[model samples]
Target: MILTRRALIAGSAAATGLVYAPALLGQGKPRVVVIGGGAGGATVARYLAKDAAGALDVTLVEAEPAYATCFFSNLYLGGLRDFDSLVHGYDRLAAGNVTVINDLATAVDREARRVTLAGGQVLDYDRLVLSPGIDFVEDSVPGWSLAAAETMPHAYKGGAQTELLKRMIQAMPQGGVFAMVAPPNPYRCPPAPYERVCMIAHLLNQTNPTAKIIILDPKEKFSKQALFEEGWGKYYNDMIQWINPEFGGADVAVRPDSMEVVIEGEVQKVDCCNVIPAQVAGGIAAQAGLTDETGWAPVHPDSMKSRIDGNIWILGDSSAQGDMPKSAFSANSQAKVAAMAIRGELIGSRVFPAKYSNSCWSLIAPEDGVKLGASYEPSGDRIASVDSFISDTGEDAALRKLTYEESFGWYAGITADIFG
Candidate 1:
């Protein structure tokens, strides 16, 4: 369980110190500059460092000192986990002999094989991994912008935005209205906005029972819709109302000053709103010429290498690989394959066929959880799901609690895998 960097040190040590041997034929170790030290980037960096021993010089560039995962932020909103519980540092990856840089990645010079940092540091690399997650499409929601995030919070990203949403939920007026505008398809955590609504309702039931939640969704159907509806009926009957696109859910605009949501030309007052808009690959990907017109980076289905630049790879939500939802698990899974392929091409490491899997778990109420999972492999031009599983809607409370417990274990295991 202790996956330390010293475990990768090859050959015997001398009496004075260790005499390490390189795995590659080069003046120095083959450099790998990973941008966005989240699930995908961090996991790849760690895997390369561990698997390659002293052959690869891995550097992870991340602005934040610690990453607060958006996956379980809903649990934090529901008071199931503390804020600190969702946050993870890079200490484990650093201990794995990876250079963990605490700075922003500004740009990627694909031709030069260099990445520029926010602090004017140019990092050259033999290979680059870009997994910077999502960035929103500006003006997708009328009158909603980054500045308006203070008033109408979009807690899609983790950290401060999540805390802001939590506070807004707690600050709701007695018997007030809480509204949520769900994002369009092909975004990070497909079922997350609905889960956040459930967590908000759970908090409201504990604090103010009369408060209502209105969900304006752009899509007609959502991930785990049947399961969420079942849980909502069982736990919070008549407390939540979901309106889909056919019912004017898609035609909506927000006015933060008046705290009004205009849906289908009908104006309604809401105490708070969680507005999640359409998203694309992170800025760094677009800047690096890795992304296409679809706003996501296109990659080879097998190894996740960029179609535009072979030396760079895309992972996680930023990657437009078919059949994979943009979740932390997907990113982590993709990272391993990319790491393996990169190592195989760079060094003399044995490579295997690419396989990927992901499971997204959502909490409907306290001790009530449901999950959807799939296993995928490379097809002609996409990663197609070969098998799938999901939690049943009619499962007993014991099973639901067990599912929730299983999610906790996954979080622990994945964080360890990525960080270490």
Candidate 2:
């Protein structure tokens, strides 16, 4: 199906449940089944497990034993941060009365309000919180499939592919070309591709000064454009090239064996390629009938309850949250709102006004970083940005250092909020 941005927005509004004006809070505990233990899901699990006490029964289902964050993945590639730093354990959630199930969820039955796992175990819940994050649409790019990913690592989700991409960079010969094909809009971490370029350039400048990096972006503008350009000009003037979609950089098809990308009928060969394909809600969400043609679930802004299934709440990158960018920070914030709404609903209470915020930081170098942040609130039918902040584009040695420091602090605080 051809997924347009407008269709996703309109579908979200229609699916949301009508507000019932809460009555006296009930006393019976409600069971919550949360899928995907990443940023948003982990945060919701932690909060519900911590505060629910005897009021809510929380279970978290994650396909992985541990989570590796994508926020500071560039630092890992640059050898600035160890993989251990980005790794988070789920013991805290378990301690807080959350049943942490490290297994794959095969299907979600909206009618039965149950989740079926690969092992044949079925989990029933009073409220379902889904934050499974994103999955690439393989058909979005011709010639790109699961097999092709072996040669061209997306590395957008920061797992094995991230390690593979790092090794590819290390193994490339000096003066080789490293090509990156960035995805279109509404993907996770809008500035991530640019951040990857900056980090890669930093590594090349140190070891292989003659090597060059190229970015083929599908969008005319990117997040933190001025800051990224300013840093590139100041540090790696002739080492990097950026081709916008209008100028023929939007290439989706990849010949993995040849390391070639077809852009507007022209094929270009490269030594190393990082292909980030277009994304949509994860398979579970889509399979559950929560998603429409646009590959995103619509939810009530105040409650985060799915429009298609009133008992289910969608959070993080899977939900069409109006103007909000799909970032870890935004997901974390939305989880809190969803948690509160769920708590109120299970106990016959009135839902209150919801407020959300997010901040995204991109490191240009080991010691240099830039950031963008915004605050959001629910409007008539969608969430609207109310305020925003961004770091200055120019490179100031001291300010850049401070930015990196702040980035570290944000990471620490967020992980703690989700797991501690």
Candidate 3:
């Protein structure tokens, strides 16, 4: 009886930690186990199932019953969309071929090529795909931990936290203060915190016009810095105050009990706080020993295959690939490459050369949007940008509105591509 990694993590290996059916290995169709059904996992699972044409046994393991995308969550926060619009289910994924398992994947046994769920179900796989997304470094903030998250919402991962933060904002007193403790470099969404500030300001401007936003960013510049600054000047002039590390963004702490935010040992009471800490690969990747010292899984840029375990592929925010930012579009693109390679290995299919692309758009105000994106190819050992584009700082309203509308179309197309 070997102790499964799941039992060790759950502390359930108190006694025998026996295996139920060790003989289940290599007995069924070539198995493909996909963990964490987010942007990366869902897309890979769909392609593998569809491309295999029922030739491979594809199983998707996701704990959450429904998914609320973190990509467009800012629009919901901005009052531009409803929460239900962002919610999606996996029922559509079961097209009489793919098997959907809704349960927490406690651990992955790489050597035995099996996945152990919390419910005691063991899934043996021929190959594995992990797309667990980002997890925070709890100790990144001195006074902020998971417990304090109730007082200071990160909302970095979409779900109840997003709702909680929205409620806190709506209930904020007039002329109150909103503080955002931004994350360091190598985060899930590079432009998220800044885009969030714009959405928050929009909501506050209509309700609590006197409220002010204070962004304490560790980095001097952020994604869409010029556009965001220009929009802030035009729409909420002098309403948003950004403090870089040069001033006081580096040294910061939070006291949720008193709702006090301390920067450089100078404390000020804030009505609400959004704390986004440093990020790392999803927990399952660490448990499986796929991640390295950087706390992110190292993968081949062309195939998205984990360098540590050739049988497993890592995608989305979990992988430390190349220059690509951790964006939804990037994840979907990477997933396709992985899916194609995996399918080619499982069945005699044509594997094409890998070419990936990504585009990220942010809304500063109503119909006022900006974008930055690029297409990439494998260069030496990393993904190199071949062509790129970004919105000019002084783009007119018409172009900005078109960009915003393009984001909506992409949201619909990508979600359908992932779920359906």
Candidate 4:
């Protein structure tokens, strides 16, 4: 008897490590395979399926069954929100006719238009969407690596790491020191590290009031610097300190084993240390040969379609689409544009001009919140900021409280939009 690859994969699906049986390829409908199920991939998949109305076969392959959003995770760290609140499952998407595969995508063959999963199954697609998000750059911070994450947690991704950092903070001895080695620019979220510092300070104020917080930043100025500093002075009352490049923040190293931070030649021991290194597009994007010298996948500003390969689209933090900050709101906005473009190309749906907007809201204290945002449109090969706005320094307490409440509403709305 002769056996084909398809027959072999089907017959030995269990033995070959296929967690979910491979979907039938070459269906009458055009296939869309989306890898990564965060804000970008999830929103795109949902949009395509709902809009196509059975005209397209959409599959989402996410490594984790449940996704923990990094956007509002700082609130959890600050004891303002619970960990469970940040987590979302894929069941709703699966129920809506989107094939939700809980497995890791190991490889992609552009010529064959196939994606190979770690579970040994292959998915053939007419169109592919890559939104695998950010990964740490190796050696970006000397002596800090994935192996050392257990000791000096980055907590920048989501879920477990965020919880771990909170636990470390709660366990700190009285008046102990908490240190953070912030990352450089063009990161996942420009304001995340600073927000993390604010959240940690908020937590320590209640639990360990005497504890000191230190921020060793490589950049001279960070997102909403004045707002955060003002909040620290008003709320934290000098409990937090920021060390910039002029004071050895640029030249820094870490000894995870000893929980030590070395600024220039000076070494300091701390009760907890959070090391956020430089970042790049996720490994899968590079493995698929979609990324460029910038370590990010370049996409057309208007359509979010890959510039390297027309059949693929890149969204979220993984995409280099100029002017847009790498935030969940930005990813969600890009996904909508990509969904429209994909539908138009595959099934002749009407395509419209793409417009994008993003807002990043951060909480400094209990009811103290600040935000920065911008609108963008395609200009010359890049997305250019059309207009921008930010909360002013020394805003009245009522406005700040309103902003905090507005963020809560946004969190609920965006999560529903992504997961549903």
Question: Top lDDT: which candidate number?
Answer: 4
Computed on alpha carbons, the lDDT of every model, listed in order, comes to 0.88, 0.83, 0.88, 0.90
**Which regions of candidate 3 fall more than 4 Å away from where they truly are?**
1-27
- lDDT for model 4, please: 0.90
Q: How accurate locally is residue 82 in candidate 1, as Cα lDDT from 0 to 100?
A: 97
lDDT of 3 by residue, 41-101 (tens): 9999989988887778787888787899999999899899999999988877766356667
List model 4 lDDT by residue over 73-170, tens digit each.
98999999999999999877876778777778999999999999887778899999999999998698898998888889999898889889889999
Model 4: pairs clashing at backbone N, Cα or C within 3 Å: none
Show model 1 residue runs off by greater than 4 Å: 1-27
How far is 151's C-alpha from truth in model 4 (Å)? 0.5
State how far residue 290 of model 3 sits from its true place (Å). 0.6
Can you list the residue pairs that collide in candidate 3?
none
**Mind giving the per-residue lDDT tens digits that candidate 2 earns over 315-335?**
999999688899899999999
- TM-scores for all predictions: 0.93, 0.91, 0.93, 0.95
Query: What TM-score does candidate 2 get on C-alpha atoms?
Result: 0.91
Best by TM-score: 4
